[model samples]
Target: MTETVQRPTLEAVAARAGVSRATVSRVVNGGDGVREPLVERVRRAVEELGYVPNQAARSLVTKRHDAIAVVVAEPETRVFADPFFALQLRGISKELTAHDNQLVLLLTEGRDDHARVGRYLAGGHVDGALVFSLHLDDPLPGLIQRAGVPTVFGGRPGWSDGTSGVVYVDSDNRGGAREAVRHLVGLGRTRIAHITGALDQTSAVDRLDGFRDVMADVDPRLIAEGDFTPAGGERAMRELLDRCPGLDAVFAANDLTAAGALRVLREHGRRVPEDVAVVGFDDMLPVAEQTDPPLTTVRQDIEEMGRLMARLLLRGLDRLHPDEGHDPAVGAPASVVTPTTLVRRASA
Candidate 1:
């Protein structure tokens, strides 16, 4: 018969640290009121004894799971198809791990999943939530609000009514788009056209606004709607070419779309940066660097943005539980917009 190895208990750790069991529990649970010298002693004892706090028992005492729900609302195909979401998730996971919190990923494909997500959040399964890929008319905003869970949006949400008090993180989509369009204009490309992502998304809307800000008098025919996919980029590129054959430049919404547009442009016998200079958003490595001539695009710190989202949500959670020693006055900002820079490559 195999012998069982015993797990260290709180009492064992307390005795080793020369403190009471209650003191060991306090230090293990964030060391709120515990002094520095004692906290260090308990920590050393925990390390020496290989003590792991019973999460279920701690939750029973503190009413916190130390778990964060990351809700991604998009098609299942898009989740795996695009590298953008994956990069962001990596950042979120890294930050959450650093804080000793659990990450519960909630993927919602459509309206049917919203109710399930809402119920799960309301059921007190997690401390807070980090939601992403919000559309203009997405039902998630309302459902999340009703659930009363502390939430941090991954991007700027569309609705202003219910989101007045909500916190969010986003890149400077409008500013990045403006810089791309301006760069094209500087190259003496007057007939510049834009392929937009789904207008329902705030990032797409902001980028389109930036385009218009740079070229206020641009003809409406110069704009084409894309679904932020390669196939959508192909169709949009075809439409733009058919509508405005004289277009000398194109600004694609994302790297994937830009890659698709580049292929279409090549098929149409257009010489990039000579006949039709191109620019894309999201300096996604897989698509941008691997493009035929490489891609010149707007670079946003996508991973950093994800990390910030988790940090902000965790800060909110800390505020919710003041007993954990987090300062209520140092709450998360209402909105955080990461800067975007223009990355020059052979394509542009």
Candidate 2:
């Protein structure tokens, strides 16, 4: 019979490093007070033995699974196809990897999926949760909170206000939209139509509000809501064109929607920036070159929001509160607020 090689364990690592189990635990858990030489010795012995700490065992002591779940509240196709979701996902994945924590992604299916997700989180599958793509009357926030899980939202959480302890991360939607509209106004376009995102979503509502705020004082006949999808944008564009054929400018809530508007502009024989200027929010999935006159849009650092969520989740894993993670308030609340800027392209 051939001899069998043994796998490494904490005990083996401690013995090899000439330390007790307690000392080994401290070093492995990154507890303080261990001497440098000893730390190096334990690390080297770990390498030689090819020892890997058992995350399950570590959780017994740390009370954390070292995992965080990012929840997207959109249909599978939208989650899979949307460029903005991909960008957010990339940012979250990178941050979680850097912190040595596992990332769990969950998509809400419906009522049944919602119940299952609530039960799973309460069962301690992850340390915290980040949710996104909220509809107007979503009850998931209340359900998740009652499940005893620390949670955050990609944008504003829908539901009743005073969500006691929930944290969220979002961009400056209203300000960004307003700035884009203001730019169009300055360009001498008064009959401007808007391709707004879903009215229920705060991002859409806020952006639409910004447009209305300006147009209320200028022209209120140029507002229409899109479903934040290319098809929706196309449909909304058609509706707006039907009602206001004389529209000279358009602002879409997101880049894809903006691109849809661009197609309609071409079909209508309206020249961009000459007969009908177009602008979009969320500078993700750069398609400026793809547009007939290239697309000018508002840019938000969505990737940064993902990174911040990961860091916050990591902090939660370590028994740190989201607000306690940074020493100074980093212009970002525990509810991170990333900035948005106007990116001018040929479309506008």
Candidate 3:
């Protein structure tokens, strides 16, 4: 027969420690009412009995769920496919774990989806929220901010309202784009056509503006917008070629666009560099390096951006805000803009 085992209880511990049930309860709950010797007696009894406090009982008093939400306003396909998004997700997940906080990821795209996301954040479902991939006129951020909850941004949606005050982390796109274009110009690639990304995004718009500002002395007809898809880039490239066949080079807004242009240009018997020079952005290694002619592009810290955004949010969550405390250190949220660099390769 197995040895009879005994379970620990508050009354048993109090009896063994020569203390009242109330005193034992205080000790178990980590309260500070009892004197030192009595506290030691309670601890001894607890150790001997192997008592584990009931979590359900404890949480009822604290009212802290110790969880957070991460909202990415993009499609499920985009979230699953994009490496940059993956990096950010990992960073946010790691930081939340290190701080013992749970994370919930929400993808809010459609109008109905947007309504669900609003309730999830504003409903007191999570203690705080971190939102990313926000666009101009995106009302999700404003809704959560008005709820009086601590919110943080993954990037600045540039010209957006109220979200500007939210702490964020972003990479430098304007300078990097200018450098890529200037490099192309230096290589005697005038009549250089550009395939732009989505204009509503600041990254896309800023890159386009940088390209235009650099080429202001040149003709403006050389630019065409692509939706950052290979097909979009191919269409944009064909249109550019049809309008400006004499175009000697192209600076695409991203690697995917550049790759698409390459396919079309090759089909049209245009040689790389020798016929139509090409450069891509994002310096995404596999896409940049695998091209028939490797793509020259701009390098950005995609993973670091994710990690920094999480860190920024964690710091903000560490202590109460100005309204909750007297410390000036917690007054206003912050916005951080990271710098960009150019990585030269054979294609340009």
Candidate 4:
């Protein structure tokens, strides 16, 4: 025995505001050509009557779902375990909410999942997408492009089809790595070793390129491959120690890897910053601050990067739907590479 409160309709709002139904529809959608007085009148009527537009009905006229898809080409385990994605999602959510848009998160695990994601994007279920494709060989970039949905990438995409432009937001990975290695060099550590992330990933490759930029003549034995995980860090560190026991420094690709290196270093009775100096990237606070002697790392604004991704996607969408109040004078959205800064701590 429940009495349901009726929702106000477009007709009710128009009658209350002494305007026609078409006029109310125009005002409620965006008020592009309507006079200010009529817009204000309709607004007052809507506020008083608690009128909410029917999204399904409105979409028919405007051709927008007011929803955005955030597609991550990663397994659920990695997405949940990494703080980087969480912080980035928070920033994206904040920006999307400010604009009254909905977020639909899509995670892909395997080829089957990639096919499903491609269909979802191509189905016209959402207005646009924000994608994260980490590896150079990941087929997601091509899949999404073929879907023909406007997309803004979380990181610089590795694959190029040459038929379309790619828009992305990313940190200065190469420059950050260079800064880290240079800092260790400033400490006068000659026998410097590096623990690189997975070479398949663009971020890892760029960071490795940056390291070589500084240590051009470094011994081949001083480099070890890591997977941007604590376990990978441990294995690489042990290998580096075994191959070059005289190494005076280690530059880990990320904070998680740095933490693992610290553990292995401790196990081997190596005193950090005394016997060897260490530096990391990402400045992930939980790992960076709690590590033994803390970690000197590069700080990239992860949350800001996420926010920028959403903003870029929305702006691009606005450009497509100029009737939704997009300014023609505003230029098309372009790729952005945010700067990275070196955060010094006790580890180095």
**Cα lDDT over the full model 2:** 0.80
Decoy 3 TM-score against native? 0.79
What overall lDDT goes with each candidate model? Answer: 0.90, 0.80, 0.78, 0.90
lDDT tens readout by residue for model 3, 73-176: 87535435547777778887877776667788887766678778887777776777888754666777676678766777777765555455667677777777
Model 4 RMSD in angstroms? 3.0
Which 10-residue span in candidate 3 carries the lowest summed lDDT?
319-328
List model 4 lDDT by residue over 1-348, tens digit each.
Answer: 899778889999999999999999899878989999999999999999999988888778778888999999884364467699999999999989878899999988877899999999999888999999888888987899889999999888887432348889989999999999999999998999999998887888889889999999999999999988999999999999999999999999998999999999999999998999999999999889999999999999999999999988999887334565645687778888899999999989
Task: Tell me the tens digit of each residue's lDDT in model 1 across 212-292.
Answer: 999999999999999888899999999999999999999999998999999999999999989999999999888899998
All candidates' TM-scores?
A: 0.88, 0.88, 0.79, 0.91
Highest TM-score among the candidates is held by which one?
Answer: 4
**Which segments of candidate 3 are over 4 A away from where they belong?**
1-60, 158-164, 319-331
lDDT of 2 by residue, 42-125 (tens): 888889988888888888876878788888776446546657787888898898877766889888887678888888888888
lDDT for 333 (candidate 1): 57
Q: Indicate the worst ten consecutive residues by lDDT in candidate 4.
A: 319-328
The superposed Cα distance between candidate 3 and the true structure at residue 263, in angstroms, equals 0.9
Better of 1 and 3 by TM-score: 1
Worst 10 residues of 2 by lDDT: 324-333
Sorting all predicted structures by lDDT, with the top scorer first, yields: 4, 1, 2, 3
Model 3: pairs clashing at backbone N, Cα or C within 3 Å: none
